[model samples]
Target: MPFYHKLGKIPQKRHTQFKQPDGSLYHEELFSTIGFDSILSNAYHINPPAKIDSIEKVIVDASPVEWDAGLRPYHFKTKGLKFELDFITGRKPVLFNSDVIMSVCRPESQMDYFYRNATCDELIFVHEGEGMLESNFGFLDFRKGDYIVIPRSITFRLVHKTAPRLLVFESAGPIKTPKRYRNEFGQLLEHSPYCERDIRAPERLFTSSDKGDFIVKVKKENKIYSVHYDFHPFDVIGYDGFYFPWIFNIDDFMPITGKIHMPPPIHQTFEAPGFVVCSFVSRLLDYHPLAVPVPYSHSNVDSDEVLYYADGNFFSRKGIDYASISLHPGGLTHGPHPGTTEAALGKLETVETAVMMDTFKPLKLTNFARELNDENYYLSWKD
Candidate 1:
């Protein structure tokens, strides 16, 4: 049986601290099939077991801090968040947190580990390549554009040797599939603009039992530790459910067509309480008597907007590069450059592609983020 909590409706003040049977810190209860809403509570689930078969022990309560800031951003919680490990590199599960940590990985790096705050659910976006995900329920395939929600503490691993790259969405609280898209019972309504059909789960099932010395890494209280496991964690034989490693391709994002192109609201792919992920793909420009394909300049007085330039020419902004992130926080006026807006005036179509995430709260910059910076981004708007 899978564990659940009515997170969407549950008041902020009320929360049940999930714990291990021993009442230690915590131990996730694995489930074979989870409904969309049931997952909002506790989504520690897998597909049916047939998709998975392996040998290893599951290590819970891991946190690997990729960075330690002398003064971290306000958006980051100084409190605590738990994480898990899944080695796509065929290593033991590992998780840890250090004031300073270095993870220089190649295209072959797997989960190794990640952190999830108590308040937010973790959203893993596959940016490139293909792979198989082994979970408690079963095995699931992950290809480009899939948004895998490992709601909280589901211990899993990636088994693809392909070029692996990821876009990770870390939320402070429960990340929910928009309720407006789902019916009262939490079922994705038939009329829902994007139904569950658009979500892709895993398909290939492969398991192994090579045992020498499996090292499990765990992070707690700003520290990282490693332990040895006798068996492989992918040992699951079968599972079935609504919760598992599913995929939602950016290409399948239903474009909200309109005579006059709409605002960023139309491209939204995933949402939590304070954040949203949107895909900006190839599409026809707006058709109107006086439509400007370029976004209008405006002031963001209350929130911070960070757009990670995913791919392609980001809508006419000259010299935009791949993977270059631009953040516009509150207290700034932003919009298309003077000529850029006018340049888009006569445009009839757009082949540009970009993946943007608008965070509701202001984001603090890590020293590393600052070091790998685009300082003159603001100056690009002028002639």
Candidate 2:
């Protein structure tokens, strides 16, 4: 988040004694990043936030095994993915590297225990579902097309109202609004595609005073550990900060347009250390009389491109459909399909929606991705 937000009750000043009804001082916990040098929040809790009952056990290995997928353009059909119970275990990694891991999750069951990803920030795209994201910061209602950005170490759980189909990204560093979209003071600029008003932070706090064994499945270094806390994780009475979970819907993005076909950066939605996420939504096409209204063939020598088709017609693609993921590695030149460029001539607009991730480092495929791979996708450009 680029702006400041405060929810629930807070004291007049920082580090001040905020007494509860029983006269005991409210516990103040500082949620910070980059060793207190970066964004942080002051959270006042009903009980001490670090009351550990016991280290129960190691739950499961959450690491994705890399499969040898030789460098070439590939397409994955994810519509056939099987549903799994719970949100954490349901994630099936498709592509990953040191900086980011991309996965598709079809969770049939809701989460029973709270989850805290200790090592990576999460960017979850709700492809198909409506749910409430309950976190220590507060509770946020998320629906389809919403990108829920959860920072690392946030104790949270997904309460599903319907079966969720999600595209999840685990980033090694903080996921942030593109720097170009913000000013020096961290406020979104007027020309930005989306502003603070379009971003939804947790408005309702879920303060709990219950005491007992509360299970929190924590993920750190690709391992899941079940930790038992003496008090409920959502014990925060108030919090004020920029470091919290937020929701940004794809529909709210106003597409940037030009007389000539614009590049991928114009569609950028979020940025991380090694990758940038772009959203392709319904928008007007290039107005140039000679414009093709589609992307031209280009070999991006610096990054790999992955596009997850969410909805609508993808004019540049032929075989891709909803829930299809196309990977174009750095070495290959990919563009509009064989006849797509010629077909797109004289088009006034595009009613397509997709999510694209361009990673600076090369991504490796997982076994699940290999199973869903369309072996002949690279040959689609052949006349």
Candidate 3:
């Protein structure tokens, strides 16, 4: 997040003596990034956050291994994924590299314990279902088409009202609004498609003073550690900072169109160190008399392109349906399928909704992705 926000109660000045009702000092914790030079927050907790009772055991190894998939375009159907009980355990990695890991999760049950991703920033796309994201900062209500951006080391859990179908991304760096959309002061410029008003931060703080054995599954260095604490993880009385979890819905994105077909950068919604995330929503097409509304064929010489189809019709793709993921790796020239360009000649608008990730580094498919891949996708452009 590039904007400042405050939730709950905070002292008039930071690092001051804030006493509790019992004449005890509230434990103040500094949540910072980039060695205290970047965005940070001051959170006051009822209990010391570092008071861990024990390290119970080590959980599953969450690292993704690269599959021996030859370089080519690939398509995967996520509809066949099985429903799992735990949100953290339900994620199935599909493509990954040194900088990013992408997965699809279909969780049938709400999280019973809290979870914290200690190493990577999580960008979750809510493809289906509704839920509330409970975090130390506060609570955020989410629904379908919402993108929940959880900064690394945020203690949180998902309370789902219905089974959730999610597309998750684990980025090795901080995920923020596109730099081109912001000014020198970090505020979004007027020309940006979405503004701060569209960004939803935590609204309701959840304070827990109960004492018990609370388990927080923390992910770090590709493994999950079951750490036990004597107090509730969401014991924060208040917090204020620019570095808290936030949400942005794709439906709120205002698509930028032109008389001629616009490039993919115009749809960029978020950016990280290795990749850029784009949103394609319902919008009008090119208005030029001789314009081709569909994109032109081109090679992604330095990046890999991945698109997750969420809903509506994909005007430039063929044989693609809801919950399908298409990967066009670097060194490949991909564009509108077969006769999609000719078919889109006179179209006025498109109702397509999809999420696209373009990574600077090459992505390797995971073993789980191979089982659902459409091997013939590379030849789908044949006339």
Candidate 4:
């Protein structure tokens, strides 16, 4: 999570009457997590946030299309995914489990209405595009290589300046920076890969006091509900707290190197209940004279590994380009593809950029994912 942020007009004390220009009190709403025990924000709105005009349930069967369970690894080529013009409609779920859902979307256009995922926190990796994420908290500008994190139940919309391609991760639990990187006071430590300066919060406010029919598409329990509000969803005039949407660029993540190769935990960026998100940025290899820079083949005992190739040359694998995903499920032995270890023996650096997710639960592949499967990927290691 990002640090405390505030925008627009707010009262000196929360829960107090903050009057508007016409002597009317601004509606005070407390947005929090974990039933107010966790991080929270206090926002003053122009209208009551609970005023709803109507609600319609839109059933979307998001259940994954799974294949036979196996011990083999899989590779999906999602570089050519076909997405519709709308943002929500274009999302194609490729892998999912009880803990998390991983999907890809290449939206041809912008979202028409607002959205609030009541069930999960959204971690959207901007693979290819520029856009502004407008929410009740404020406006957050995002570009390629950025991980835009939106806390659960925050109404927002993505306004893309160009055709946007995104890799989305929905966490059943709140997504936060690795606790080890933060101090007891919740501030990032000096040794952390990224600092507060690298984290970008919503800088500008986008408050709307307009009264009209506004649609907010809410996702709850694997179903989308069209909720119509009597007032604009962005009616928030001001808000302040530790809970808000923020962005962290993958390029800003400084990889930690050592005499010998480091473990995957060193690359962890975000963590949830049953999963962790990692950023594999371009960095120097191990400095040990005889060290093998490429990772050694090992068995993942209780976690499944998913890697999404964003950009740069991935020297460890073949036939993987931008937007390619490789899944190494639990109980399988995987590592640098054949010959990668030998090739990296004398290498000083690698220019590979990728996003990786390690989940405790096994992920099921969707039928749409099967369409883009590289059936021969499992045999790529054969001589």
Point out where model 4 deviates above 4 Å.
Answer: none
lDDT of 1 at 182: 72
How well is each residue in 344-373 modelled by candidate 1, as lDDT tens digits?
Answer: 787877765556666666555544444454
User: What's the residue-level lDDT of 268 in candidate 1?
Assistant: 73
Per-residue lDDT over 23-76 for candidate 4, one digit per residue giving the tens place of the 0 to 100 score: 999999998888778889999989988888999756666555676546678889
Better of 3 and 4 by lDDT: 3
lDDT of each: 0.50, 0.93, 0.92, 0.88
Of the two candidates 2 and 4, the one with more favorable TM-score, higher being better, is: 2
Clashing pairs for predicted structure model 2, backbone only: none
Q: Is candidate 2 or candidate 3 better by lDDT?
A: 2
Model 4 TM-score on a 0 to 1 scale: 0.97
The better candidate by TM-score, 1 or 4, is 4
lDDT of 3 by residue, 1-383 (tens): 78788988788999999988999988999999999999999999999888889996657788897788898899999977889866788899999988899999999877888999999999999999999999998999999999999999999999889878999999999999999999999999998999999999999999999999999999997899999999999999998989899999999999999999899999999999999999999999999999999999989889999999999889899999789999999898888988889999999999888999999998999999988898898998888
Instruction: List the candidates' TM-scores in order.
Output: 0.69, 0.98, 0.98, 0.97
Q: Candidate 3: RMSD over Cα atoms?
A: 0.9
Which residue segments of model 2 deviate by more than 4 Å? Answer: none
